[model samples]
Target chain A: MTIGEVRENPAPAASVVRQPTFVVEPSKGWLALNLQEVWEYRELLYFLAWRDIKVRYKQTILGAAWAIIQPFFTMVIFSLFFGRLAKIPSDGIPYPIFSYAALVPWTFFANGLTQSSNSLVASANLIKKVYFPRLVVPISSILSGAVDFVLAFIVLLVMMVYFDTLPTWNIVWLPLLLLLALVTSLGVGLWFTAMNVQFRDVRYAVPFLVQAWMFATPIAYPSSLLGEPWRTLYGINPMVGVIEGFRWALLGVNTAPGPVIIISSLVSVGLLVSGAFYFRRMEKTFADVV
Target chain B: MSDVAIRVQNLSKQYHIGGTQAGYKTLRESLVEGIQAPFRRARKLLRGQATGAAELDETIWALKDVSFEVNEGEVVGIIGRNGAGKSTLLKVLSRITEPTRGRAEVYGRVGSLLEVGTGFHQELTGRENIYLNGAILGMKKAEIERKFDEIVAFAEIEKFIDTPVKHYSSGMYVRLAFAVAAHLEPEILLVDEVLAVGDVAFQKKCLGKMGDVAKSGRTVLLVSHNMGAIDALCETTVFLEQGKVVDIGQTPVVIQQYLSSLYDIADYSLQNRVDRGGSGRAKINYIYLATSDGLPLQQVLSGQEVMIVIGYESQIPLNHPTFKLTVYNNVGQPLTQFDSSLTNALFIQLPLRGYVGCQLGKLPLSARRYRLHASLDNGVELLDHWTGAYSFTVGPGNYYGTGRNVVGLKDVCLVDQTWQLLENAPEVHWSV
Candidate 1:
């Protein structure tokens, strides 16, 4: 959305007082998202992410072990219900590795979305007193979830080795795919968190939404069942592209995800851009009613 | 002009009166309204109604047409009674909340101490909280690192720096919190009434730091109920009344004008004063001067027999309730106190809702206006701690029963004593 001006200025103005470092009023119209302020406070982003990671693990007997435990057990349940019982097609790869691969990124997206969606309300204390980019709250909440993603990824790699599936040169596409997952997570997070500020019912609705979203993605079954045009049409749900791309990158799957990636990428970028603008619109009113 | 650090133009903030429910409506109410909106409109049309009944939400202007400017390196004081929009103005300037009308242009980096320890984590160590709290207050990482040792020394918590802040005593927590705030260096600083809390020594240390900040030539916009601090540090003071800017000028004159207005607020019944504290076991209904024969008097005279009666209402009987009445001059300085417990004054079981009076042999002060702070403690808990419960002026009179009037300028109160002057020099060698 910020193809225009994107700064709430960090002017080093020694001479121009009238130019003013900032002008405070009830923001009118569609203003820039002030991403420049977000960049200036990057260290706060790190500290907040660090705080979340540290505090979540503290005083728990399992600690970061829960990070691996959560996705692994969920994968086991999927392999049982979808793979063994339902005879769900998995593109000829082992279903455990198949589900585990998707679970790594899927867990990251789901937890990140849930945490970031609730982040603003949980940080009401900081919001009411201080002035900072409210964007930092949801972003840092997402960043903290990446730690668990990495830990879970290590387990997925170990599972991959056991299953004898290897990666190809397509692995280079992994970073963009992970980024797409994050953008999608943050996009939906911004919308829902902003809405949660207005309507607390969003909090109760999130887990249900996440559960439905996971099933909508191709985690339990391959997208190949729906033939050709419909198969590609299914990529309207963005995570389909992410999960399929991950499979193509790691397992050297024959289907290259052609139109699915294109459609999904377009949809995701749209979600992010619009989500940012909507978030900026709601940002001014947060402290007043938070 | 470049020298103008802050220019506020008719800045205002309006809040809905029953705002918590009105502004933050539950999703069910919103959903129901959304679904029923067309029907409601149709029903209104059928009834031939022209008014918009749904738009009947109440609102209040916390700040209205508030405009002021602070020159570069000037310390400006904001003074007002409770709910006078003082804190709202500071919040708007600090950008914590946006103004609904107009705007303010702040020239430099803003640091606000609206409340100390703004984002301190209780689970974190004192050391971690300093860095985290500093960062939240807009200090950079290196800035906090450079001042790390200084902050620790300032808080005097070197030994407990690594311990979790949750374990700290309340006093230590406040000290550490103020320490981080004291170290924040911004181009413009907006300080709220942070000095009102903390112990005597802590308040002095905080005041000393505030004075240092004022002398450092940075622009400062300060809001405080402490007139003494406002007068000591600020060159010009802005007086606010009922959400509007009432006066702004040289500090002394504005403070005098603000204090004079305190007398106007005294006429309101304490039942609705709103500015009071303590547990709600009992409430001070009103307080006024009374003649010895128990008729109410508007004012008293020095060297005259006077009685002050306190009216109160309580849910339960006050058990031998100890009462304290403190007198403060118009400048908010405590002048004298009459405490019942200290004097061993006896009382039977006090009625739940009734009057109690303390008789004075002679009015102790002369020729000045004074306010009263009356408090009741029912032995178990404080029932009321009402400041400025009443105010009256004493006419010039001979406090010592002398032929001349007592001058109140040199002291707060006058005491009686006979002076023989020891004309013989007392050289009778009683010590030897």
Candidate 2:
């Protein structure tokens, strides 16, 4: 080919004049989120979530089995420590089954809390190197914990069957509770993840927070034991509602958990929106700081 | 009314140059600043503020007053030296960082391959990373599954696809990462210099894949130091210096312009003052390359007397912290190396901050340029190093050497070299 011929193209491809379109502006306000943009990058979200799952299961002799083992072992320890030794109340359900049910969602929440908080910092290489919706990192981290949730749920189901206590009609309420759990986890995860990007101390503070949080929640005991007003106020800890609801729905526990569920759901959703805005506000500095 | 696929106008991104420690301003200080912000902004908007005189503790604009446009399907290359703001521009364009001033508008789905294999888990197998990377690039799970075999084949890593990426050589990781990114099929693709990771063959494949994407009527922005690749693939090029667009024009013209101007920058003085310190026993004060007369020469001709000057300071002088210099060929293969302390020049109880200037006469280095890899070591302990002293060219000269045949020879000999000679055989006189 002649040099000129090499320079001349066979065809004019897509000849559209490039013009400047949108300028990225820093999000204003204390907590402002453009969720639409994140929503648009949903494909990236799915892949990151999938990648987390595959990596977690990749080379081990027991692949997805590790997901079940973590929560299963934690449940065993909790049952032994609080159930047998402390003689904590379980709302009349078998201690193992009761704690395991609550542990399923709590494990999901705790894992999501730790992973998502560190997500922006941990993916510093990727964040610095590529551009996508920064929220995808932490959200995927939270979603990745879903694998453990599913695996542990199976164990929960087996435990329920072994105890010969089938879930009541209230079991249909399970999806809402699961969504509630996700919101609560994501909300808290977003705040910590954003904070962790700016202050690395957040990473150190997260595990200790999770440990303290497990004690604060009634995973070992019943929220009902707290009595009136305090019991109603106890729902301010959103997980109280989730754990109580899990027991009520699965074991047919008589404590209606009434206004507690309503209050917790509102609180969880509020945390999610607030956390998302906080994350978005802080996200502008992530590439620079991280 | 030209069709502009990407448009940037008056764009600027400012960054505080110091550590995050600067982030901690007292609450009272913040309150005072918060009260003043609105009035300051209003006054600036009403009348343009002048005299940016107080430059200390000031924000450095990574990209300032940058404006450009790229039509659909236009493949553009961004070229610049280190810290010249190529990455910053890409970050702003890709929406990684919001520009502090001005605006940039991008139409269509933008996918950035800033660092390939980003999100690859070391504990995960190559197969998993591919899917993960593909997803990060915005491909659907179903889409990746369908192209799974093709990606694996293109990476030429089918045998170890199931092996964790940590076990794969960096080359394999890069190949697999590029394959996933190439197949992502975003409307607009922004690539950084991460392609430097792969082997030559894989890089060629990556270039081909990028070319195919551009040909299929997709917009691409490529940033690479490889002039050959830029010349071959990019239709147009943009040159950025200190975060601003210096030139934007046709490919070969802009690249040639950039290469020439690179030589024009005479910041060789930075190499004159050297600071080497990092858990080291001996410290190097000055490192330089000088001509026969001990005059520092920025450029060198072949067969010249090139002296290596090394000044150092020792603390509790030991047997090592051996001052060494190694010259590597263009492809990073060590050519001719010299270590002073190994040759019994080890100075014991050396005066603190002493000078050790070694003059090697009649430097036999050929026309090709080489990097001086100077380091100090105590046996296996690496005390300090000047990773780079400036590189100077060696011009062809009248040296009576037959091995000069390898001077301009490119490719294999330039990398793996050997010397051979013609000798007279007593029995075989086969020449006509």
Candidate 3:
């Protein structure tokens, strides 16, 4: 279908202030983001999120245990290699407590990347057969990763007790940081998932990207390794603020991640906005290319 | 719009149909085209020339200038041969894909069983998948809870509901999927080709459920290859051809128009996509059915030659073998059996054959679609046998004028004729 004359309705737009166009014309011009329509389908978002959770744990020998085990064992390995042997800095907190806190968010990000990157390809049958907002597939993948995030947070609680550390008033900011991480994951996920549908090379590229990203973030080491603007520069990774915010909230860092956290938060939101725009732009090609 | 359940005006979807090369354009090609595009556009503007967007290369309209509206509670069947844009139209209506040209507004909550078990997890138990699929099909958890028992009973998987679905047979999987889709109520239901998966009995059950749904006043859009199912369920049918609405009218008339165009070779060429199954493992060139009198008939008269010829490529000699052919009806029921092992040509062998012709003489059959099932094997050790290889149509016929050929025959494969003249019929009074 070629682009035709644009038709505008006088209906009031939703909270997302943009001229919401129901029709999409690929040949005409730039793609417009329709958050209003997406907002209407929010119930579908919840159902898809629920479907992902049920399917993930259904019939698993470990069931929900795998969720806890992933972050927990990761805490152990980081403790052995980076904590005791390598003598990596933990910002004065017990290394075990420090790494476990970072592992919680890192695991969510890693899992989100893994699931969302393959989502479109994995749901090829659904794409070819039926119609729905294709973005729902990857978005649900990210949301479901939130389930494991909450479950793994329990282990972080136990680590806090073992360290005899209680969360400070700063812990109120934890939800905001978690939102930052979520936005970041969804952002990167959208880009990779759309690419994965076309190039298929993204499947192999994802694991490598995640591994490099983990070391790049302060998951195993502290952002302290790269001092000053570089650390703030490292905040460009976005997840740095999320992990450092958890450490600061639970372990009480003297500096509240300060400029680094702000930089990281801003970068994370930026990634999310740009990723979504790219995804919306490329969405029209998916049905044909996939 | 009369509170239209679904409305579309000039809905069109454009697909690039990408080239074989990755990234589509190489760096050098992009460089050359990049340099040429600006110059061409500038030259055209300076010379007061015109540019036609339609001239875009490799551009094909999968759906073009399509428009329609469906009232709530209507059962509409989208009928067309493959690539006629029926699926694309459905996809746009369901919002699976956005329309490239026009606008479509679907009122009320829409539930699409686009494919059976669209989100079914293999590792999940049948019970778990019920919940997963229910949610995927847009059902609330409480809604699923209310219908859980009915769904289980309908799928007939109560005994193994707790077991992982991966362990269930393909039939069980489809049944559970159908059950979930059937029980969940939504304002509108969009079903694709899933009905073709389940067995005959299950298909009937699904049809019955769909009939109930229609009576309950919910919009239903069904797309199926089975004309019989469409005629029985859909009150109106829309025919699509080459991405255009060719016809939309009463079920029978629309179907007649669609099938009437099927005799031409173009009809067959448009649909066949080189199916790889049954005889795919063996090297076969062509397979066709011929009458006993050596006449190639598309519509066979009952009690005519039902011979099958198989062309194959063989590089080496073959041993003493038996060839078996079983004929099946359209519904996959075996109507006749002809095994070479039972005939005198049991030990025949061909040495380094290039092309071979085999024949079966048959003068008995009922009016129906008969498929050719063939197998070539040395006794005991099976080489290859094509199960449900080819199909031909058999028309009803009367063999005898006096002794009605419809004489009751013991064999199901036997074609017996029967006739009676109402005026000449005799009536006898009981001697009480």
C-alpha lDDT of all candidate models, in order: 0.83, 0.74, 0.72
| Residue pairs of candidate 1 with colliding backbone atoms | none
- Model 2, residue A64: distance off in Å is 4.5
Residue B199 alpha-carbon offset, candidate 1, angstroms? 2.2
Who wins the lDDT comparison? Answer: 1
Query: How would you encode candidate 3's per-residue C-alpha lDDT over B1-432 as one tens digit per residue?
Result: 224566667878776553333243688988887798767754542332322232244556889887776767888888887788887877777767767787776767777777788878887788888887786677777889899999999999999999989999999999999999898687877877666657778887887888898778888888876665676678888888888888777776676566535444443342243333333233444355444322234455555555554544444346665656777766778766776667666556765432334564445766655666666665545555554445566666453334344332333466344667789658877897
Q: Candidate 2 residues B1-432, lDDT tens each?
A: 235567677788888774333442889988887798656644532232211121126668888787777777888988876777888888888888877888767888888888777777888778878777777666777889999999999989999999888898878888888788878787778888755558667776787787788788888889987655676678889888888877888875676456535542442443444445556666664455554333344455555567765655567564545778888776678777788876767755455554455676556666776667677777757777875443455656433344554354442222333657757646776798
Pick out the ten consecutive residues of candidate 3 chain A with the lowest summed lDDT.
A1-10
- DockQ-based CAPRI category assigned to the predicted complex of candidate 3: incorrect
Residues A156-223, candidate 3: write the lDDT tens digits.
88778988988898998888888888888888898788767656778998999999988888888888
TM-score preference between candidates 1 and 3, better one: 1
Interface quality of candidate 3 as DockQ: 0.21
- The candidates' DockQ values read 0.34, 0.28, 0.21
| Candidates, ranked, DockQ | 1, 2, 3
The worst-scoring run of ten residues by lDDT in candidate 2 chain A lies at A1-10
Q: Compared with the true structure, what per-residue lDDT tens digits does model 1 show for residues B1-432?
A: 327788787888987655333453789988988888667755643332321322346678899987777778889999887899998898888887878898888889999989988888888899988988988888999999999999999888999999999999998899999999999999999998887557767787888999999999988888887665776789899999888988888886776566546544544443245467779779876666766544445457778788887767788878888889999887998878988887757765887766677889989887788878989887889889987777788877778876787766766677888888676685675685
- Candidate 1 chain A lDDT trough over 10 residues, lowest sum: A1-10
